[model samples]
Target chain A: MTNRSFEQVSALLDDAIADTREQAQQLDTLLSDNEAQQVWARYALYGRVLKGEAAAQAPADISAMVAARIRQEAPPSQVVQGRFGKHRMARWLRPAGSVAIAASVALVAVLTVQQSQPVAPEQSVEPAFATNPLGGRSPVSYNTVLQQNAPSEAERAQQLRLLQSYMLDHSQQLQLSLQAQQLNEQSEAAAPQKDDN
Target chain B: MNNLKQQHHKKMITNAWRSSITGLLLLCGFLSSSAISQPFQVTDSNQNQAVALYDEMARALRELNFEATLVRSSGTRLEPMTWLHGVYPDGTEVELIVMLNGPDMRILRIGDDTSYYEPHDEAYTIHSDVTFGLLPAAFYKNFSELQPHYQVVGGRGVRVSGRNTHFLRILSRDNDRYHYGLWIDVESKMLLKMQMMTPQGDILEQLQVTTFVERENVPIGMSDVRGIPRPPRLYEVRNLRPPQFNLQPQWLPAGFELLRAGHRRVADSGLPVDYYLFSDGLTEVSIYVGSQQQQGLPSLAMQGRESIVNSTQQNLAVTAVGKVPVTTLQRMVDSMRAVEPNATQP
Candidate 1:
């Protein structure tokens, strides 16, 4: 209806409006008019020429190239905030989802493989052997050279003292184990249903 | 006439097929229902029987006078030992444990005084009602003491030491600690074999009896041990008090309670350490929180049923050791958080 329609269509193409949805709809309505469409096409060509994007010699298949590009693109009217936002979200999530799945698969594979393999043998401490304490000599000789032996003799003695404490600590655990058994039984009786059942 | 006969035969075959299918479906329904009901009936009785058997085993160990030869195996090493238990006419209990391999080590307990005699170490005595042996600790303790942490379950009967034996497996409720399986002689109620397994079902240690003989008189060797001299003074554990630690564990397996807490000096480093002991009845773990001087020790190591997880937090080193699965120990150490002085509940 007014020359302002051509200027508004141009502004919509350049994304110059803050409210893009209203401007896009206005441009769609204007394009329906043949006269407005012709003016829009002429303005686009003129802008491209001014920007030096137009070819010096027109390409022979330029029309075919433009048609193919238009076919590849989504319809401008359909690509609004909601649909395009979802498309962008899906693109962003694809790699993150793939990485998470890959990590879980690797973890499962590793656990299954570990379960199938035989357990490795534990390292053996020095076996308690017969020694004459009355001889006034350190009779308990270790077969494996312990790391503590690397330090001075005082360190080795300290290590033995530490071993003594460890043994004492372990011996005390026997009492706790007995207590645990009783507690477990009481809990089991109070709740007749067990986990395995 | 032939056509009519063929039709009758076809009708009979179809009826037979339909009835058979219906019967099959009925059978499946009945089977599924019974299977669903079986656990309640079976497990209830099994629980009662297992509890009774555990009580019987404890009574057998206390009242019965028997001498048994046992072999304890851990990793590649094997240690054979002889266990002796007797009750005198004056109502005194005497038990002796003799190590038959590599060591001239022996344990002698008369009433409440249990003494340990090992090579190159002074014979020290500790006041205890039960003597330590290769069998599980569950055998010597009362059911009340152990019922809170481990579930006692009856397992299939098996032959052990050439005797008919019934199994009572002590399963940890949380599945984070070690599990123990014991085979008791059906007739005598004596423990025939004991096996300690990791959470993943790997055998870490086993003690199996080779010979069990009831003695009418006290063995001559045990009588000779009764005369050992003793002083009134004993090596006392000085840290008999509660813990003074800022760090408290935030996570623990089910039924695990704090048994002992104190501060003890490290014999190797002379660094003071806050110690806490936790137990789920059948398994125990010790946690030590000290200065960062202990960081040079192994971060993680597992041997037999015992594992160690050493970690540091906020310039403090936390080490946990016990006969538990590695993951269990790791969780205990990782859950430790430094608490504000007023917020500390333990």
Candidate 2:
């Protein structure tokens, strides 16, 4: 029989062709032929799988050696999605990460350069009070009184440092004397207790 | 087996330490409560009332074991802090000032050394009786010393901190300096509020006590801070010759006497500065003289209650700093003159 006859037989078995006397005769003929019966059995198995009626069994007809070899290799189904997705993402991020790091480094370089520039007199003297115990009240410089918004001469900065140091020393001295007085009183108070003992 | 034995020993030691700390805290709490139950005497006398009030307040500050939450305002900035003062059984004075907002700025005074602890700075110690940064130094001094510089007059009685208070106006003897107004608790003679004002009545700075708690036992932080080592001394006046200034002040305000006259190395710089310290008992003014060509002092600066006036005479640069009006400091500058080669200057 021609392959066209086999195709008619397959369609009749699936109930896709019109049921008639002619299709019934074709189905009977295909059932008698062993080769056509094998083809019909294969189509029935594929249909069972599509309907999810059976477990997805490996081809038992294949040799054991061939099945084992296939299992040893990477699974073909997941290889493309898993490996290639991560690879593509990493390729895109490389240049972006480099740019971010470079931008931060450039920002730090700019800040360092700005610090070396001469500061305005007000900006320089006013901020020193933040860290000073006297806060913003302490005097700066010994000769030239710096007015608001005036330009600070580089040499005057040294004089300011000296004046601040002097003020700190003076406060320290006051604290020391106070401490000494307290200590003396403490010893004096202890003297009577010692005598009683 | 040896390791297991060592672990058990460590656990026992830890348990003992915990129990001891708990016992100490309970004892302190009990003692403090008992002390607070005692009635504090407050004198409201008609004879020498202002002088007696001042004396009583000074004594309360030095002798009382108390804690106060105060608001200290300078210009537009206001700082809220808790001040604790206690006397140990051994007679050592312990005080703590804890800032309530922002960074933890703490100053702990145990006997002689006052140590400052701040978040950004290294903890350092200063030798002081009372922490200078919290209250005016003059408040701790004897009332007799303050008489010449200030006129302590009694003002109308008012209520402060929920207590009946008497106002003591510490008016400057001269018009050139700032004045202070104090509200003393009538019952305890404890200072409830103090304001430093300009000659024109502009408030420069103020300290108001919101809560005053008197406890008999030492405060909590005071006992804990006793173990912390004091920082090294920052200033040492070694064997160095005193400086001779070419210019000297010709006049000083009434009753203000020269305390000391000497020269010290201007800060860390090797440059010499002539320093003259003058006081009228309560108020102190420091005059620093540096070479005009070497150092540049600001012409005039005023922050809160303190004013600094700077002037140049001949080759000398003179700067005066105190809680005084600009005119008073300016008068000091105007009074400077060059001394003769053979003549001694005071």
Candidate 3:
């Protein structure tokens, strides 16, 4: 892209970041006050972020801080299972633990740079491979660990079935009310000589 | 050069004199023909003579003793109604009896009050206006005023009920109202037959006299036919109250006036329906406003002599009714709106 196009893209990204921060702040306030509103807002925000909009990714430091918070507040198995599902929990946990290991290696590079030594060529590729896994088995092994440590399958299945039944019953009651209303209208039309002249 | 100038001035004077003389001669010839033809053409004289004739006709209508059968033809249906009218010599007694078949209907009018008798309903007194149907009393009260709005043309003379009649056409000046043609008796000027025509020249309704009698010797009791029970009052009607409109329209077609206004209870929701009526000397229209639901929009349906047009806004329905064209009805419906306090002329 031309320099001008690059600048335009950067400005758009800046706007997107500002808008996301405002919405996040609003969601935080709503979460403390209105439970229903907060749940709906979080679902809407998740839909926006998953739509492949490049502007959804935060700055590197902010992402790391958020990840740290998740680690501190939630058990690793719960975080892995929530994002990747119970079936895929084992696959996500293995790569996530490796990322923590890569983070420690990046700390050593920072210390070497400050000592005024040129980094070795082997160390140059270390950050890339550590941050992201390349092999397919890596994801599978990671998920297996998360699934074993998370909730049991039978408990999750029972809760899902209850929610489905409740929704079906509510819809059936609405259909019955509509049928009764139509019957009343038909009877009124049949009795024409009641009052009108 | 002097001779040429003198010749040109003489030629100009001669041409002017010749043209003026020709103009004067033409004017004289035209005036003479108009004077001679004045007696031949109907409605050539001032309205004073027509007004006098109208007064005489009204007096004859009030004083004449006659029993005639009138056949009212509308569309493909023909209805025959027998009418009996008489006036006492003392000018105090008057009676009119009209009887209809099929449904077995009879209307008896004594002075101002009228009583209707029907097979399924008991006899009861009704307002004089109801007895007239859609006929305005202004036709009988001051028909001379209509002369200005209608052309009085002559039609083929005919004989009705052994009385000599001359046809008098009352063509309307505009298509805004219906036209009428009446056959009046030459001697008494009493209307013998009348036909009402639409704008397209189609006859909507016609009342023709099959038979009529001019009675010089009639019994006094004929003017006082009694013992007829009045029809039961099936409908209790009060004058519709006028609505307090926040805005009144600044422009309306000429010859229209507010007739009545009031609220009616809608059958479905029992909500109050606002209604208003306006009339020119001839045509009448009723407008209605009410809260709109899915069914509250004005729907149109035609039954015999009546046609209704309805329209709805966000929450208001407006309906206009008359014998007017559908376009006119739609225009009236669209013009109605809730008046705002600060409405200004555009």
Candidate 4:
């Protein structure tokens, strides 16, 4: 049998498709040919892999060639509907191993969230009163706690710096307000007598 | 095995050092709290005498020739400065404040003009009666004018800064403002210590004169300031344009009056903000409105007795800060209503 007949038989086994009468006639030609029967035996071994049986003697290059053929033709698999059903390895994992992977991923996400519960100091600030002795600052410093959580360190620092600048500017700078007050009251009050000589 | 022993010894030393530091900090905290526990009495006092003493201090602070070496203590910060006041031979009043710790924060008030000489910043002068130092401007103004909003009570005698002082307390008549405690020298009437406190006896800020020199002449510092030539006041902000936007505050404490309404840029950061300054003679509160939301202070944030309240409406951030109650600040922020640009306030 020719290489074309071997390819035809291989496609027929991988897809489990002899849907058209023309394909049936072609498979009939492959079954009567010699080389096509060897291709058929290799596919039978691949089929045993789906049946929970060992196929240790199967050639490694056969699996590679099948992957190459799938990439080149982009075949619409008749036996497979969803993405997982396309590959022989994934075909065995479909309804059970996929569930196990999903469960592990969800477990990891929940644990990550739990480990980060107390990380956001700004959002977690409670209504704090000035109860600190010495009448010092009341907000608890989160610096030591935040060392382990590296992502938000720079952002929290920026917020605190901005807040400080706001307080300092308002409390310290009075040039503008003084100007307004000065012009409002011009004579005989606070300081400058405007040297009206 | 020897290396492991060295590491263990180092760990033990570090642990001891940390515990000692913690113990010292706790002890300091206990001492300061105990200092405040003996409340300054706010009882029946001769209101007329209290007013007379306060009026005398305000006048002495402006007209006296003396040098006051003091430190303003608030929270964990200490700012030491020398305040010198004197009269020149040509009838010019000169007052100079030299910041002792920082780099070149000198303020000189020659009569009504105040000049600030700050390092790394342009030295500018403005026409004003007093420098906007941490010192309350009311200390140089007429305090009796604010008597309607406060009840002045004379407390027991106390010694401050090596001088016999008459202790006095000023309580807000209706809890509309912060209370004040004063210790004025009996001889010169100069204030030796002034405490701004919450109504609940929590001291927010304290300014204490550590050393005071009653000068026979113009204070040496003020005389030096007179010889230090000043550039002509050519850059003073004059012809002030009225505020463009109307951030009309609907509610204010009784006796509070709008002194100034205009636009201003925040110092250092140079962020543009429109503001209004209100004063009830003794204390001042300022309300700022700006579009930059990041500069808004957190809700009910207190720095010493200054309460800052920030609120947002239609993307505009409103900030009100003063040495008043946080509830009053929040209420002021709540009462603020933003109107159209240049619209007349109703």
Candidate 5:
């Protein structure tokens, strides 16, 4: 019925058919188009040959391969508009119901996988050493470390200063542990070897 | 028929004897176990009494409007603080602790939001019930909650801070951690003096809270805090960063868990450091990890039980400061494992 049927069937084989409407509008043409039918049959035979069902040689024509490559190289499609497009689409819509079925199957697969995705637990920062972290009710002063003697008064001053700030931060920033989660996500997204280099 | 009857009677007598022997064995086992546990029960009762006093002190600390002056004694150094706690007519609790000897260091708590104003550092707030440093949370904490790892024993009554007080010796059940001896006021159930002691009964540090007043209503000192609106809830805190744990100390003494971790810089010297605070319910230690800029650091600085230990691991200078033993700190530093990150910034 139309010369473009061969190309449409080839696009369908490549899973690159853009419009369900266009394919349905040309279904009779594709069935009647001898060259398109021959390509389809050859593809089926070639698949059987792969499965060792038929002792056959390789396909003689590379037209289907060329068609798939052409489809890949083609510019992406835009929405079809205008009165004529609507007129054709209305007629093709009934047959194109099969496309919706295929889409529903794909959606089910995606949704099933989404349902299995586990959710990460929530974490909140609590007072340090005051009690059990898993929520035992206690406020016992938490005990931490020990250091050797500072070499000199100045060194001791520096150590003392560091210790003061460190302890201050230690005591003050109990909620900082919440940042660990963001740190984990950032680590995965960021490029490796960026820490020291 | 008579022989059969006699045999049946003999079997019943044997069965009864066996059953009686089994019952006797079971009774003996139970008695022995109970006898062995009788001393444990006595200790438990004594511990319970001490813990009851501790709980009373904890409740008093929370519910009472009190103004207390505290002095921290560790070796020759002495630091003082003014601790105030009160509740509003609306049931909003306010607690404030201003370090008297420090450079404008203080901590304020309004309900669950706690704020810290360190001497030269940007004052920041956290959502927590307990404040760190100065007078620790342990003083007002229920001692029974530290059980399984810690135990409390009743000690002889003694006068402390001009009040008749009873001593409640609270220590680790396994003797692997620091111990505390609290002198609680008998009448008021307030803690007057707390001694951080070692397993050897040596005092590591002592905090003496001289009770000035425990008012029935809100303390007058809290007038400054009343109507003081809570600080604006922090922005979605992405920009306000905390110290991150890039290097984690994998080993800790038993019962110690990471309480908090953050990144900060020393005000005296611009030294960026990563630190982790670990606690064992009673005592806490801070482990600081920073890049080794120059050579190694001072291996240690120990004054009494308080110690600051430094070591270099994987080009990162690690320091641990706490009131625990230096060896434990060193072991913790040695256990530093650099977290494998996809991206790292030194």
Candidate 6:
């Protein structure tokens, strides 16, 4: 590509990377909110299914499911539609789409399974999802797995915060590397012409 | 095996003898040259004549009016240029126009005021010392003072620029500054060819008389050059406070002494800078002291024409610029200290 065209492409890529990072952060915040917990749970479930993990069985607590769904997806769907369906989907799908799809599938499967299962107390299912995956892990157990599991409300919040920071840092570094590569290519292309002189 | 051992022993003995002889010859050669060049008593009348001739040549330089084409050399680079008219006694209205051929088109003139005219920019003014080339003021002041330092001797005659020229060697007493050799015109006493030699006897600069005209030529005024504008008067004479040194240097190189000191405004800080000048008859050093800045101390060892500037910053930023070694300049800076207000003398 010509130098000017290359620069233009580089700038567009930079903008795309920045936009992706901003959307990821917003999704993380939306997932953490108590009102949007069920939608967030669906997204997390979808993320697990995409990574080939089994979907969580939905709780028999219909009242909680309906309340959580209304708080999470209803507002977002209205806003997304009010803006533009295709454009909103495109923005959300490009970066977080894999995790998002997995989270959705898991939540749908859980809800469908709940329709068939016997009713359980609201607190029992909440503890299963909210507590550390290895809550009953012994002291002799490897610390790596324990560290990885985002147990409790505080730990999950901290995990999301750390993830956002790591993603932002990585995205910034990638953008800088891409910019340097583009500059090097331009300089290399110009060098031959200068040598000919 | 015994035969090989004997052969090796013979070779070793031969090598040792050869090296010893070589070393002895080198020592003898050095001593012989040193003896030949030594300053001996001037008993012969011709030796006195050589000194007298040099004295006359120095005086003649201040009186004669002639046109010359000179070539100045520094290291591997050579700058050829021409100059026209005037001398010191005549209130010399000299015009030196140097055409810098290599790298860029630079035209320099030293007359009523030093000016540089380049094709890319308008003519700009310069200071006197920079414009007068590298000839020391001591040469114009007195020729006899240089006799003890430089051993002047006559050399073989040669014809240059279609005029008979007599050569003279101005050998140094020490290796501090470079040596000079000159070819003077037999009749007019005009300098034809001048050469500056390195300490190791390598020619650093050579200015030859490519063409010479000793005629009653009318002097050219500064206005004679068209398109070249007159340089504006930039220096404003200000009443400045004399520099006060809190500490004095215990030791300085021979012939060097403090000349002048004053406080002047520096460019970067726009603050009063304590400035001092020291000269060893020929070479001059300027020392400036001011308040410290946010930036780190500037590095030492920047080169000029036979000069080096060393700067160091502590509580104060001290800069010493002169034709001296970096170590010498550093020592000068280290010697500086703060003095009491009452002790300062204007």
Candidates' C-alpha lDDT:
0.59, 0.60, 0.46, 0.61, 0.57, 0.46
User: Per-residue alpha-carbon lDDT of model 6 for B151-254, expressed as tens digits?
Assistant: 67766557876689777777655544456777888898777778766444556456776666653542332223333334332232257587643433444545
TM-score of chain B of each: 0.81, 0.78, 0.73, 0.77, 0.72, 0.63
- First chain TM-score, candidate 6: 0.24
Model 2 bad stretches (over 4 Å): A1-173, A176-197, B1-47, B118-122, B233-235, B268-271, B301-304, B340-346
In the order shown, the candidates' DockQ scores are 0.01, 0.06, 0.00, 0.04, 0.02, 0.00
- At residue A124, give the lDDT of candidate 3: 22
The C-alpha local distance difference test score for the whole of candidate 2 amounts to: 0.60
TM-score of A-chain in each prediction? 0.27, 0.28, 0.20, 0.24, 0.22, 0.24
Where is model 3 more than 4 Å wrong at Cα?
A: A1-197, B1-43, B46-55, B127-131, B144-156, B160-163, B217-224, B227-251, B266-271, B294-304, B313-315, B325-327, B340-346
How good is the docking of model 5, by CAPRI class? incorrect
Q: How far does residue B176 in candidate 5 sit from its true spot (Å)?
A: 3.8
Indicate the TM-score of model 6: 0.44
lDDT of 4 by residue, A94-122 (tens): 11101122223332332244336643432
Among all candidates shown, the one with the greatest lDDT: 4
Q: Output the worst ten-in-a-row residue range by lDDT, candidate 5 chain B.
A: B228-237
lDDT for model 1, on a 0 to 1 scale?
0.59
What are the TM-scores, per candidate, against the unseen true structure? Answer: 0.57, 0.57, 0.50, 0.59, 0.54, 0.44
Q: Encode model 2's per-residue lDDT on A1-197: one tens digit a residue.
A: 57886677668767877768877787787778887777777777777867867542331221132224323534322332343343332221111102122223332332233335433323323433343223233343322333333434553454445444444434443444455445556769786554221
**Candidate 5: which stretches are off by over 4 Å?**
A1-165, A174-197, B1-42, B98-107, B115-124, B138-141, B229-248, B260-274, B301-306, B337-346
Best by TM-score: 4
Looking at model 6, the pairs that clash are: A42-A103, A43-A103, A45-A102, A45-A103, A46-A102, A46-A103, A46-A104, A47-A102, A47-A103, A58-A110
> For candidate 2, what is the DockQ?
0.06
lDDT per residue for candidate 1 within A1-197, as digits (tens), equals 47687677788667786786887787778667888777777788888878878653222232233224324534322333233342332221111102122223332332233334433323221111121121342221121223223445465344334433443444444433333444455568778765341
Indicate the DockQ of the complex predicted as candidate 6: 0.00
Candidate 5, residues B113-211, lDDT tens digits: the string is 665544322344445555545545566567655766777777666787667888777767644466788888888887788888655566767889754
| Candidate 5, position B341, lDDT | 71
